[model samples]
Target: MLVDDQVPIEEFEGTEFPSPATVHMELRYVDRLLHIEGTVDADAKGVCDSCLDDVERHIHVDVDERLDPHSDRENDPFGESNVLAGNRLDLADLAQQLVLSDMPMGLRCSDECKGLCGICGANKNTGGCSCENDTENHGEPKMEDAAQ
Candidate 1:
């Protein structure tokens, strides 16, 4: 059977979504295994870990899971299937878990991001801060000047 639906999820991996994730998948049950294959589309809204700037991006996750309908995922902590309850499947949770597993940790707006300043707390990518350069010679103002 073919399934088309939208799952409303608040956030994934500490990143919020601008809208619901559109799920398009094909499900087939054979013998004792249920095979699921599809794709999920979402718009992620999050802050860059480096420069702390607002970042948004479109994420597409390919979902492929083979679940045993009779297996109990709750009893087995290491089991891969957790979206199934008896004969029923939770599509919303499935989408959320799939997206969460696919998300990357510690996101940055760009690889060239200079990040924030340590002293003045300014974004280095946007023309840094004055405090960084003010302290010269490894942040020491000369021993003679400091003794005064």
Candidate 2:
């Protein structure tokens, strides 16, 4: 059975996160559990780990979930509103779980990202920059080579 007839939560997917490309959903209520199925488009931007340049990546999110009222999780670090009470349920938690569960831990624009140069702090993704190579005074092995 559907909860609210006036405002449908299904209308919110594509609008809230329009850059992902598309979103479609199917929701059902049964035995105090909410079954959800959907797809979402997502775009994420962050500083590149290598060059420290702004990086953007787009991803597709597939959503399928079963949600039951969780009243005992007052200690959750994210927040308390994730759980609903009584008969009135919150669909927001289900959305949050689906998004968080599948999010990539290491996000990069590409696999071979030439990050910022250590000597000059130039964005290696762009190209060459003239910087002093401090090999003697620093006396430390190349951090990049160690990583490799």
Against the true structure, what is each candidate's TM-score? 0.79, 0.54
Tens digit of lDDT per residue, candidate 1, span 40-100? Answer: 9888889999888998877799988898877755665457767886677888888888877
Q: Evaluate all candidate structures by whole-model CA lDDT and list the values in order.
A: 0.82, 0.52
lDDT of 2: 0.52
Clashes of each: 0, 6
Clash pairs, candidate 1, are none
Per-residue lDDT tens digits for candidate 2, residues 1-148, read 4322211222232222324234456768778566657765555555555665666666556766665544424434354434443444444444444444455565555788877778778876666764434553354556656888
